[model samples]
Target chain A: MNGTARHRILRGCRALALAASMLGAPALACTDAPRGTGDLGLIVERAAGRLQLVETTGLTALGAIDGLGDLSHASLVYSRDARYAFVFGRDGGLTKVDLLCRRIEARVLQAGNSIGGAISQDGRLVAVANYAPGGVKVFSSDTLELLADIPAEYEPGKRAKVVGLEDATDGRFVFSLFEAGEIWVADVREPRAPRITRLRNIGAQPYDALVTPDGRWYIAGLFGEDGLALLDLWEPEKGVRRILDGYGRGQEPLPVYKMPHLEGWAIAGRHAWLPAIGRHEVLVVDADTWQEVARIPVAGQPVFVMARPDGRQVWVNFALPHNDVVQVIDTHTRALVETLHPGKAVLHLEFTPRGEAVWISARDDDKVVVYDTATLAPRATLPADKPSGIFFTSRAGRIGL
Target chain B: MPARHLELRHLVEHDCGSCHGMTLAGGLGPPLTPSALEGKPLEYIEAMILRGRPGSAMPAWDAMLSEDDARWIARYLKAGTRK
Candidate 1:
């Protein structure tokens, strides 16, 4: 074929890809968006007493649902099956919405005061991190029924406040207790009656914990006490091995000075990329050997760290000072790749299962921004009223239940 | 006067110690003890009660309590705990 004919053939293939994505079903529309490459979406935090779904296909404003009043600190998670998206409200209510049906099917009252939650890989359970009266509630995926309310066991003379929860690949759940400086592990195989096992004295305050893909180890981000705590899940009794410390050096620890330190961590391949929020950089540690391999500078206040499914590049979200954008870094070279501005207060982010697009919750704007992965351009914005926590389902053709 | 002190005591037990220390000794913030309130004058204490200590976790009680109610809290913290 002639050179011009070959070029025409490539362009024709690209156009077909775009057209096929547009014609895909609504449930699969989210996956069609570029993932690990940075395509984003918005989950609007609607005003108190109302619910609204803003379709991001063309960034058009969708209608609203009334009666779900002023939900503060709302976190959303779509099931693995993608049949239902559970919205856990701060007021202790869990609103179950069917994305395909485009309506709330059932509302479970008082699913516990939640900051956010993680849905199981199998879509069997939704583990909610209760902020107040610290604990977690494991709810059934299909019925949205409350199965377990596992409270963090407070040590003698110590107060424990549950800050975050993340589900592990192995039928277990990890809960971070901020005040107690501990992470509690619970066996959720039974769901209803979970056995709580305390992993104590991890750090000054364990703010967040993330399990590896294989669920062999758990790494927690300590807020006040800088650095990450690596816990051996194989032996939960031994507690965490203090691997890395002084995440953002030069800043004094909390209760002294209020500069935030280590805030978020993401596991990519054999490297654990940690966002040093106070220092405005990211620290990469070899996951297997657990040693600092590289340190790369990034934009201001990198809070949330997310990676591409292929572990090629790591994305960092800068949260404050009116510059809400994501910084992409090359994992191999540990170099700055691109900086794409999404919106204000980009608190939480997630990539589609297929690694095509990235979705971010714009807290200040009450909307979700979806960006294309390849171009790193803002593709679409989903209108949400005060949307905070956002997650995408791995299921191929199902929307939220 | 004793009845008022008793009521203030009850309020301290239920409301004050919940976030602060159980004995008003301080949990999330400074204690409510005499030492914690020392150098803080009666009027200053009243303002702190109504407006709350800024930059700290202390939330303003202007919406929850009135001026007189705040004053009562000040008096209780200063004198009512004296027995």
Candidate 2:
């Protein structure tokens, strides 16, 4: 609807809300009638190529929508209004889905192979990081219309696979090249005319990268080396700095069955909790200095070391044989306080807006386990069909999700 | 088959299946169904598993799986059977 229509509707809602207040029908207050996007979330049914619309507060799945081709490695980004979700699939399917209506508004197969995607700071543009064509494609978030296409070419005839496409502050999108060992920042203020800034020789096989929640720093996790490369967006000319060098020096890293997700790294009070790739430890880095402060050992190779919204605890889930276990760490003390065995093959974990409860998806068990964070007890378990990623609409307001 | 091979099958169906699709019908990776593998050569299938398609998301299993192991997985995938 246009602005005038939206304004008229808002005026009507306010009048109704005022009338309800005068009648003393407290329950009918518009303020209490689901005003925020915090209630909605999405559960990815990987095998079925469907998305389950979930009511996060009630721990109930409303329903599932299908025809999303190749949802494996699918990631979702909500529009600024949180009314629509942009679902990026592995088969290059970019779908604009309506959350309220439970339907796909538009979809287009833009590439042969896509890893994941990101939305611009303003949420006007959505970009997909492609593996096959080795580039990033920018789309109009509202229409899913193609805007700009930037090929990640490292050599004369070689295009590098783009990964870790994240939206930093300003109108820029930052991403790393897995094969090129470089990080490039694309400024898409004009959409049609994008300015590219490339940082070379950052690190070997920078598997994935993440922008800090404040959108200040971009850190890339290296696969071929021990340490990670960091870049300060404010001072891009300082060059890339290598921190936490030789982290895996003495010991041989066990075979990595699945690449650990770097987006899972959490920034809590004073420190950032990062998963040590191929190791059963959570490396705590001093967020201010970007130095390794401590390492808290855990059950297995940590894939998702997510901090609660309150930043009081860091919840961790592992990879492979240890995926069944979920561990909670007290961020203040930096100690493992609780370990819960939710089910088999726990693929992902998501916390509610206030961090009162957490929802975890166990693929093999085919159920999403919800736990009360304070009580550390099971609150509810929702059955799903081979679920993986659980994304909340609350992520819409966050800077780097 | 040995117990180790059984474990390998579990890994393929669950671990690799994380992206390849639990039923092996394909997701991020191509479908490994019997009909999909009908015309593909046995050697090509095995090599694909062992070396992987480097430019794509598929990682080489050379560090983790042996040639014999890749051969077994290739045959099993060609058969398109899942537990």
Candidate 3:
């Protein structure tokens, strides 16, 4: 009970507190590490509501933007300079996002009943597929101004619907008619006024189209035809050639019943990965010859096919047959290398320019799942109020505002 | 009781088990047999049918089925065992 004894006890207690604080330091640091390194941004599309911006890495809810109603699809196209991202939606709503601020600077309503759209390679223009009117609307990327509304030609007695639109490397916009069994080619040299030069009959109900990086030709998945149609974009006058028929396995040639709806297609390098919506396998075709090179067995109905910029791996998203994973195929081996089980109903997938990360929009979970490109592990999940339409800007270093 | 059992059995064969499984053995979903339901109650099955398991392939049947309909499904699942 002396003064010296009391001082010694106080010193011992101080040292004990310091030791405890040191132990707690590591745990606090661990929390910070997970926040910065987890995931970047998630844009959630709520059905008949606004788009919610979420910071996945920090687990911070950024807030929402009103007026983007019932977004059925969305694609984020970053400028080549990586300065900004043009967020294109299915409802014909275009928003110019300042990637750094993650804020919508400009909003433009291009047309009505738009289902999907794509930005030009130069990032100067965006072409949208109008579903109800059966046409495409071209707009200026920088100003969010309407450029052209090209009318699509349909088959006799068949009402047409434009389901997918993609800008070919050759400065032309290729559009797929959902129920018309045709694809229209339009020249967009003058962004404001597109001149429709050719209308080619591909097959039964073309759903989606993709042009090879080389820009020599384009390929489309025929929903009712259950095959892929290869087009010679080089000669628009001669029209598209039905290079491959019954490209996906179906019951058309069999005595038994088969699910033959070929829904999604993508081209990486010289190979085209087609997700057979009716079957449990992905059909790989040689982009040059349009020949069925290989059929890779997958778990469910593969709905979306995307390839990394390096052309090394092709990712397929399953829609039906009920699988909660994205299957990655090695292009060189033509084999299933890895399966990314991120949650459920992965509808759309887009890869960053560097191929360092992948953004997956899962409809069932209403969240965008971000996976590390190298590890293929779920690094973060961006929760959307009602998620749909995922696109990343091709422009590097800038976040899609 | 026989009529109800037959109706429930018909529903399992046609509507429910077609996608889930043939013998409730789990094709697209987990098996719904008695062994698989071990430690789980009928309320769990009913809730799964109503709300569905989030982040899963199973979809909510709340709009399509009533509470009584879900209870019937759970009862049928409990009674039928693939032995």
Worst 10 residues of 2 chain A by lDDT: A26-35
C-alpha positional error of residue B64 in candidate 1 after TM-score superposition, expressed in Å? 28
* Best model number under DockQ: 2
Docking class of 1: incorrect
Q: What share of the true interface contacts does each candidate keep?
A: 0.00, 0.12, 0.00
- For residues A1-401, write the lDDT of model 2, one tens digit per residue: 56685566456556665776799844222222234456899999987899998897667877777889988778888888887899988778999986655667799999977878888889999999998788999999988899999999989889887888998888999999988999999999999889999999998888888988888899999887889999999898898999899988999565455677888479998899998976788999998988999999999888888999989999999986688999999999888999999999898999998899999999889999999999999999999988989999988888767
Cα lDDT for residue A374, candidate 1: 68
lDDT of 3 at A22: 87
**What's the ranking of the predictions by TM-score, best on top?**
2, 1, 3
Clashes of each: 41, 0, 13
lDDT of 1 at A13: 44
Off by over 4 Å in 2: A1-36, B1-10, B18-71, B78-83
Ten-residue segment with the worst summed lDDT in candidate 3 chain A?
Answer: A26-35
RMSD of candidate 3 to true structure, Å: 15.7
Chain A alone, TM-score for each of the models?
Answer: 0.76, 0.92, 0.75
Error of 3 at A270 (Å): 3.3
